[model samples]
Target chain A: MRYLTHKLIAFLIALMLAPVMLAPSWAQTPTLNIDVNVGIREPVPFAVPIFIAENNGAQAVATEISRVIASDLISTGLFREIPAAAHISGVSDFNAPVQFADWRAINAQALIIGAVSTSGGQLTVKFRLFDVFAQAPMGDGIQFTGTEEGWRRIAHKVADTVYSRLTGEAGYFDSKVVFVSETGPKGDRRKRLAVMDHDGASLSFLTEDNAIVQSPRFSPNNREILYTSYESGQPRVVLMDIFTLQKRDFGDLQGMSFAPRFSPDGTRVVLSISNGSNTDIYAIDLRSGARTQLTSGPAIDTAPSFSPDGTQIVFESDRSGSQQIYVMSANGGEAKRISFGDGRYGTPVWSPRGDMIAFTKILGGQFHIGIMRTDGSNEKLLTRSFLDEGPTWSPNGRVLMFFRETPGADGAPQIYAVDISGRNLRMVNTPSFASDPAWSGLLQ
Target chain B: MRQLSKAAALAALLITAACSNTGGLFGGNGDGTDVNGLNGGPIDESSIAYFQQTIGDTVLFQVDQHTLTPEAIAILNQQAAWLNANPTATVLIEGHADEQGTRDYNTALGGRRANAVSAYLVSQGVADNRIQIISYGKERPLAVCSSETCWSQNRRAVTIVTSGPGV
Candidate 1:
């Protein structure tokens, strides 16, 4: 019966959109067309009431799930949630139709209704989104089932669905971040590896503070992490399984190695190795333990990040007498410098969208987090601070998270996230001082 | 006159060192002797302590500069003479930078600075085998404050005797 209802709703939505889909481009053209190149600055007004509890002992989970979904949407700075008290009608039945007139009267552009049930130690959630302006359901309802402990992930999935459907872009809510958690004082700082949800929840420490760790990066497969550890009294790249916590050092290539980033395929890693004289970039095949020197020069070339397509690598080098961003073939060749700005550029991370590169810029004693086109045009600075570096792109490439260090004896570093449009800059709440955040691909 | 204040500062440092459980500010490995030359006895001129206290262990650089100045060269010349005399001691040259640059570039600049000092010591007859170098970048700062005074002090390369013969 539920499957038939879903099919009917889907067909109805298709029928409703047929007219707009069939309209010719020339016929729909207007004399005054507004080019909305910029993003939507004003938050869209939406409503998410408390989900209905369909089974005994499911009311608490239903309420908490609804709250999580609402918070996730609001945190993106793109949605404004209308309080439940503001609604003229309450949704008490899972099968009842939405009162679109009541929602529209309250100025709610979008409405979400959901129900939760539990049976045989499994939790199930069903949700439907409605377009109040059109006085109709936007699409067919969907359901998710999982273990009770995985309720937050299910909530994130629902939020991701709503965000994607409304914005026409992929949602980054269902992602994870790996970073270096720091504690103790400035002189004797201790660091460990930590992973957390994208909204700074569900944090789990991956390593102890016995050894110094830096620059933890997630593999494209999202099952392992690559980081630099000083366990042997010298920095070396270490790869560890995110689930098993088993780690192995890169086979003895000599010298100190740091700044390891996985290739797009997750089969290899590119890192910086210093040989007492100069530091250069090297790519290592993780399985075969074979190494290839990508950059061979007298200058320092480090912080290598591969493009999304895996055909090229973007890195920072001092070949031009100062630090600048450069790009070269994945197999290694003469790197063409891409950044010609007045200051220095380092830690250039290619966006997942493959159109821009986010980098840390240093100029006039201040560090700025900025983005530029791949060919080094359309530069825009998103943040400026005493010390801000190490930018990691969100899975959707619409946001960036970086660490900012305050200046003083008691100064501490904290992680912060900013939209690519330079609006909605917010600090990510961490247990303690944190830096070097790396966002994981969407979880399976 | 400057020598008198240097002695006074050494005395003050030793007085504080006596109160702390850890070794002096530099934390030399449980050595009872004053490494900062506070006792003023017949000091071992060939000792790393003497080289650090008298010839100066660190040379400061300008912002974003890896080149050594004439003053830095004079100090390195003295360091080379001391290292040549203490031939058995292996030295580790640690390069540092102020917190004004990105971590990666500052790391490379720190490497360049350490290399510059190492190359100068080799040019002055110090064997390359006796010296090793590392760049801490801006990770480890000698001065925690953010002013120019602190930044100047943090942007330095210090030569330390890591192992081998001791004075």
Candidate 2:
């Protein structure tokens, strides 16, 4: 009986020790901590097989959707799509599990499988992403429903999801670019406001070529545009609804106003107006029409762009006897010069990320599109040409679009885009001569 | 036939004398003969054509330099005299830049150049009210080539007589 009593006490002690060991040791012990330390410099190998069609009528749409998604991801310079001919397996069923071994054999690190279905004019796209190397799905599968007419946008949405899941950042594929479309010779150039999908698709003119339009900027909400119109014989700032195509002029100010940009809140517009003698920066309330002059010097102060927070303004000024960049509070106050580089800087657009500013720099008889930190350090030039000006930032602050004018009389200006990392320089295709590109925020 | 030839020769001599007195073939001054009417002693050549052709309407500037050169000053002197002669004519000074600078800065530089011309014209006895300034920046170029020759001609301020005899 004494021996049994001892054994019971010992069993109780062992149970208490087991709890302690389980709580501390497992919690502290490190498991296989896999970290993707090296950045994805080379494009990640991905496979986007043709999406399966639930019905016979959905086959064409499925093919087009898969093609668009693959193109979108490929254009980012971060993902490469594996061709169908090289694929060892095909995704025949939407609900079936991904064959990670098949994708791995083809050396694809990521795999995308999708299916398309149409019912009563409604198109549905369902997609799943898998990390082939990990041999499991990366994220939960998603499905999007839209009309037949919006199939491209639906494709872009799937691409955006796959991109965000892989890169851990928001995607910019589902955006639009508004720019000035040009035609005719260099001397008598005709320009009109044009808008297109971010990939240069669905191009449509927003305005006629009756008047000279320039410096188009998208409002934060992407519902309206603020641009300079030479409709009244002098440059005037006007706001127009992007969808309705209706416009309202800023209340009659006495002088010529141009380079209008919306405040972060979209309640105000900051622009440059020439008071017959000198040009200065001014901010006007959209609702009240009250004017506030931000700079009052005898020199020219123009191209006023507000910081992301709307608390500060960065602009180009010649107050220092040469053209340079200056930053000041949103409200009128003493401005501090930010650029001290060798070149003259203008068109200073603050990045949406609030970390850098993109600008056009002129030096040694060449124009360069460059970026610098907000504090004016680490200046990097992305392009060089006869003339490259009017830089506009991408919605995610990862890319910049500007106009490049070729050399000589027939020098047509074309829009070009470059990543902030100084790679993926590409010419944005347009029907004719185009310039002054402005990127809008992601559509709601 | 000899008499007719003599008459033609005399007419030619009169035309040559008239052209020379007006300051060469492409001169700003009108011919000494007041053929176009107006009670004329010398026939005031204060028209816009005279200003553009003879007095010089544009003055070129160095790259990014707004300071007027001596040669530019010489041209402006004649422009000032012509402007002072015609009081009713108001001029628009359009400043332009070469395609070598940023659009915004080039615009600002163009503005400074226009302002400089306006100030100099005012200094040269031309009324300030008679001159208005605009900066086309680099939008309009007289020379389309990319060489220094074309760029020099592009970086200039052109005084356009908007209203008056020129109009």
Candidate 3:
């Protein structure tokens, strides 16, 4: 009877502590903790090691991918990267067992490691994440394969998987960017449309060097681009195929057409047309060459972008005297002015989720990239610089890609990306000048 | 050939006369035959003459729009007639925009304006291959002002004569 009583008492004690023990292991972070929810606390602390590839193995992919992963995670501002120099143990092998005690000694609550290999003209990468306290993987390892030059994209996919596993949110690393490549002096500049991976790799030009091209936006699938070019020597919207580089003018608008943005459905493009000295918003079907006038009147109705549902559009207009953002139905109707702030706003691009509108704000002689709700409330500026404009969203709507121009002694322009929270502002490395970035949707 | 010699002699006489008549009509700033002072203010007669000869009859735009006015069409018709006379020369229709919009959009708007003119030129019997369109959105402006008037003048499509290839 005494033995039976002792065993029952032990069972009762464990039952009482079961709820406490069942909580998620990721709930605690001594270095940092990001709630990422309404009324949440500080950011989470995580350590990402440079993925180790074998000596003759995926050396090129291993280093490139680790950097992209670091960049993507650091840009979120919800995680702090513990320096690699501070690591207690170096990750020297891909399948080498992790020492949880060593990671804990460095106070890393979460850890990441990856490995790369190449065979048969294909590159394969596999990565794993761990919860040090839980003494297990936070999730299963991910494996991907691509070309050697496409190593950055593979890294981005890995980062995306890791990010989604931890935050329950979609990752945007596996994406691409289309932007304007600028050269020559400011007065007589030569601009061309260029596309690259999201981390600035595999850059290739789409237009010839003769005529200037700008504001290149990718179609939903990222297989085509819609931009304005002076190839015909007039500012008209033109569509270019990514693979063949074949281009066709949008339509015979009989006037200037510009600020072309593909609709959310990707079948139509909304742009501005200057008919008889009056510029208004117009939508053109890429398939049928059908045209629909959206904004009527002479108030510089340009930069038309569709909402996520394709029901409404956000655009810039000087109808309210100074340039400001306005919202109207996809079919041109009475537009309600949404900008009531202290500055002028233009290039109002709708967020992918239909929640916010990103714009370029100029106030007090300063240029800023800002965002506000569709109703034009809760306006917040993400970046303030001498000149920063042309904001594009990541596939997941968590980050933005834009360009910054510093009137340097050398006269150079640079491209940059930042989280919507105004954190992790970093320069995207490129050999030449880059501007007017348009982020593409997540690659399949 | 006789007309060329007569014009050269007339130009020489005018230069000497103008040099002697300095500080009177041409005035105190050494602004002789050169209409350099014309750049600082409103369109002067000498500057208008220069514009008429060099820029010809050009149509301007309003901010981001690229529609031509009746007056602009009339000017374009004149340009088309001139091109019809000079069939051997290829013309580049250059588009421009004001500084009111984003540079990228403005660049596009400029292209649109240039294309509009190119299409019109083609419709007027100017061979499609003879005309090339290019947009310079808000990059090069004739006037530097944020006002409506300046913007109106900045949005334009000017016909530029292209010397033969490699020239």
Candidate 4:
């Protein structure tokens, strides 16, 4: 269920943060303001004190939400948290005046304080950001209300606001990833579709372990998931309702269909169907089931992702005699080759920002997760490993999540995330081996 | 001499009856094992297990290449001959790829390999309607290691035979 937005909360105060010019001290870093962005500077230090509970009922949840917010901010590898234990001053009251000297002495560039209350079985959380150097509130205070069961999401929303205000971009903490969870030996591994928070919380399996599910992609709305399942003894694109867990398949076709992805509008799904030795991309209107063949050639064409505006689609095609990234009209037409690198490229996903295309590159027996400009310039490999493929963009397009498999019999695949700048590469937590991650849009 | 000839014909009749009804009972051959080979029981030249074990059922490919190699062609030739001989069996070609590629591309690559095998078998007189194929992609690797040693084995098309109604 969609959590209640902050507007629905009985708010005494809620204000949006304005994007403003950063104070020179923080902006003085060489790459902070540069558009080319090869920045590898020290992480911005921020402080998050325990949110003050307006009543005894919200005491425990307040602390937990604040902690999650801190964790969320720290996870980006962009911000260094000034731990609560080190704070010399606390905001006991929601409207308490801040002591700037105390925060300035700790060298924190920013500070955040919040308060939570319970009313009519609904929990309301309000938070404010402070620019410690300027000694003024960075943004007007904002609050959100939802059921206690949704406290984590509420916390994520708060973190999202803080992150956006500080970084001058959209936040991705409120997103989710749907991936394939694997178990058992490599020969006969059990795979199922699983969904979880971007930070790896609230994981739930969408399909049974016995079914071999592959390449799950989230709808633009985050209400449905499109995945390929071998339940019918052939890979077929299956649509599943995220809430009800009900599924409907495309039924048996002349050939197996796999690697399905939703258009940005969520109105159609594009997938690869193999007819004999040739695989081509086809778009099916979700409402009409009208199948349109986007690419019709004797080559492999799959891993189709749409531009954020839903005007065009970027997919991989080997029509050039080797796998390469290509772009074509969403309505099916000529596709121009975009990848000119010295390797085979596949699994091309257009960034949500529509600026770059992330893809899996194979060269000299090494697998890499890389991105290039939409026009195929300035290609940069973000990661190189024995196996690294299927990069999915975070909501803001600043980070990517992909799977990496280690070498050896004891090795297995795990989910990993990295910023576009090629820093903060960390493994995401999962109960078992996971791969083929598809990130959902930020939750409404 | 006429009486001896009559006794020989009667013995031949008894032996033929035993072979038909009791699977050569009392013939000293002791070939009474089940021929259908249900539950992996006794199997002979016509059994599915014979097709799997004796005739060979897998064809491997090189990295990122689905074009059948000479060794792969030899295996497929054997498989085609087996399928031609055992027309009552159905084939399900399971295509697989190594973990060296992306999921979607590898899946399509697996399909190419399986289709290559199927096209070869059909060309060699195997019925098209009796064969079905599925690409497991890199999802199911024969060997767990990430090295070429395991990848070579992983990139293969395995022909699965099942008992079907007689042609």
Q: Rank all candidate structures by their DockQ, best first, as comma-separated numbers.
A: 4, 1, 2, 3
RMSD of 4: 9.6
Q: What are the per-residue Cα lDDT tens digits for candidate 4 across A1-444? A: 232222212110121222232232332222122121555478788898899999999999999999899999888888889987788887898777889899988987888888888766678888888888877777567768777767778888889988887777899997789999999887777888888888888777777786788889998888788988877777888999877677897755579899888988888988989965999988998898888888887889888888988989999988888889999999879999989879899989999999999999999888999999989999999999888989999999999999998877877889999999888999999999999899988877
Candidate 4 has what TM-score? 0.87
Question: Can you give the lDDT of residue A298 in candidate 4?
Answer: 87
Question: How should the candidates be ordered by lDDT, best one leading?
Answer: 1, 4, 2, 3
The local distance difference test score of model 1 is 0.81
Candidate 3 lDDT, B81-155, residue by residue in tens:
766666665766667786555774565566668877887878899998887665666666666544566667778
* Candidate 3 stretches greater than 4 Å from native: A1-45, A50-55, A75-80, A83-85, A92-97, A407-412, B1-31, B34-101, B104-135, B141-167
Docking class of 1: acceptable
Model 2 spans > 4 angstroms off:
A1-39, B1-47, B123-130
lDDT of 2 by residue, A43-116 (tens): 88889999999998899999999998998888877777889999998789976767788889989988888888
lDDT of 2: 0.79
Report, for all candidates in order, the number of backbone clashes: 0, 0, 14, 0
lDDT of 1 by residue, B34-136 (tens): 4433343334576545666668889989987878999999999999988888778777787888888876666667877888999999999988888777777
TM-score of every model versus the real structure: 0.86, 0.84, 0.73, 0.87
